[model samples]
Target: MSFIRPEVRAMFLRWREALVGAAILLLGLYWSFGVTPGLLSWVGYLALIIGAILLFAGVQRGRARMGGGGPGVVQIVERRIGYFGPLNGGLVDLEAVTSISLDPTEHPRHWIITHEGGPALHVPINAEGADVLFDAFSSLPGLSPGRVASTLKHEGTAPIVLWRRPDLEKRIARLH
Candidate 1:
């Protein structure tokens, strides 16, 4: 039920800072030549500084986007995973994925996947920020909402432990 993803949190913070700074700067400008001129001027300067910092952060994010490392493609498959020994709860099929995108405003860090006839899953992973969790999950292979759902019985919950197959990990390591 969480609307905002973790990755987007940083962007929100930056925006809030920018707005507050702008308001303070406006107020300072209004009272520049009025009572307590020195104090008002200092307040205005502080506001400007805060606003500039926020704006700079936002601009830096924009630059990352321009660099063109787009989010990976997600294809949704409706297959379920059952117990299989050590990997009973860890194996995930690649055929199951819906859509994937990297819009920081929405879901950050984790990819939000909605199964055809199942619950919506959010797979958390390392990302530029919490809001970009989607990018991190989508970037990796064999990890989709349904795949995660198959292993984890919880939805919209935290600390979902994933037990990837050691063989697969070894193969990945070899490739790397």
Candidate 2:
């Protein structure tokens, strides 16, 4: 029933970027310790090396996404901030969703947002049954109507807001 598939390829963009950055930094540090004697120069070199690697990876990945080779969905279910369920077929806690908005398109469109201290994910839903899907998300208990807004303006173009992130820290605090 879900469109988004669970795959390494589907890992969030920010996660990928962070992972790549960490990898580059670690590699640079290791290399620096081996070849450099000056601490300041070593740190500088390490930064330069890490930056270059991350930059290269970002560009390549961007090109891939633009080319339509991005990860295809398996089962895409929106989740609230504190919880991460199985992708596609999982339930999201309404309290964690700070906002929900519909993405605008040339045709009908729907998207969900989750606040994760990053840009909102503009998930594209199947247009045919979008109304039903929208209803489903909207009807979730505790969902705030004010959070869901149409991205479209008078200009006749825009992306839809799907869901926004609520305060995740509070959720975690409650759980713990």
Candidate 3:
């Protein structure tokens, strides 16, 4: 029997990375300012930097995560993202993606990933394995993780374009 309630456990699981990062940050603080000396102090400084980065990334991932169990399953393989949902689903290649947008007008927000020569794939934010999209989206060229996280957390009714391929932007500008 577990003492922790299921809801509490699930919450912890969702923020596990941030929790770990916080712990590391604490350890680094203690080592840097507490009783550690010389080389250990320097190491502690390094740890501080690493901890801060991890914490930032963790917070971003945590914000992006929508607790799953919404609808559909998301899979990313070989840089391709595939969404399998009851009503709608599609596959999007990360490399060929031209734009990524968030449609907050939906019941549960949906990520509209548009790729070259294909229909846009609409993946629900809370879909199972959707958290993995954080890493996948981060790997896209010139995409900013901070911007993505901020956009994901924004409470807006209109659709927001999160990222666009730089080359595509230049091409469209040239044509206009």
Candidate 4:
């Protein structure tokens, strides 16, 4: 039994990080501007810095959620990426992925994972439990998790390869 409405609660969950960031930023700004000229000012400055960091991180996280629009949840466990969506869901081994790319043309950008002789795995960026992918994807050679995450928000019209296995990379290099 709860007083909160379901839709309102869902919206809160969706933007919780950004909301927290906004709260922190507001507190910092209030303290920095409202307080007297003393040691508290220094504290206010620290808070401001922390708040700014949170705001930036939170905004990015919110964007991730917005971009990851999909029916199912995404989970990363033991280096396997699992999707439990309404119409489709499956698991893929991170270690077995030969190439990773960001398909920016999609509505909520998708992280495309390709493996030898297997259909590409499409993982929505905002899928629940997708955050865990940072570490899992970081383990792939030549892949930068930070770069991958940063690109997730970009609404590019073309697909960008985040990482490629040495064989594929060399083949492409040779073609040039």
Predicted structure with the largest TM-score when compared to the true one: 3
Tens-place lDDT per residue, model 3, 1-176, is: 99999999988988888888888888888889996488878878888888888888888887777888989999999998999999989888888899999999998899999998888899989999998998998998888777778888788978899888998899989999
Leading candidate by lDDT: 3
Q: Please list the C-alpha lDDT of all candidates, in the order they appear.
A: 0.41, 0.45, 0.88, 0.73
Span of ten consecutive residues with least summed lDDT in model 2: 63-72
* TM-score, prediction 1: 0.26
Off by over 4 Å in 2: 1-71, 74-93, 106-110, 116-118, 127-132, 141-155, 159-176
lDDT of 4 by residue, 1-176 (tens): 98999878877876686688778777877777898778777777787888788777666555444423455687887878887867667788776788888898875667788887678888776676666566676778776545756776577889898888888778999999
lDDT of 3: 0.88
List runs of model 4 lying over 4 Å from the truth. Answer: 67-72, 84-90, 93-96, 102-110, 116-118, 124-170
Best first by TM-score, ranked: 3, 4, 2, 1
| Preferred candidate (TM-score higher): 1 or 3 | 3
TM-score of each: 0.26, 0.28, 0.92, 0.64
**Ten residues in sequence with the least summed lDDT for candidate 4:** 60-69
After the best TM-score superposition of candidate 1, give how far the Cα of residue 153 lies from its true spot, in angstroms. Answer: 35
Per-residue alpha-carbon lDDT of candidate 2 for residues 1-176, written as tens digits (9 for 90 to 100): 65766664555542465466666766666666656577755785767677677755554333223112222232324533221222332234444455666555533243555543455444444322232333345465554333332222222465544343446446867999
Candidate 3: where is the Cα deviation over 4 Å?
none
When sorted by lDDT, best at the front, the candidate numbers are: 3, 4, 2, 1
Off by over 4 Å in 1: 1-17, 31-36, 58-176
Superposing all C-alpha atoms, what RMSD in Å does each candidate have to the true structure? 15.7, 16.6, 1.6, 4.4
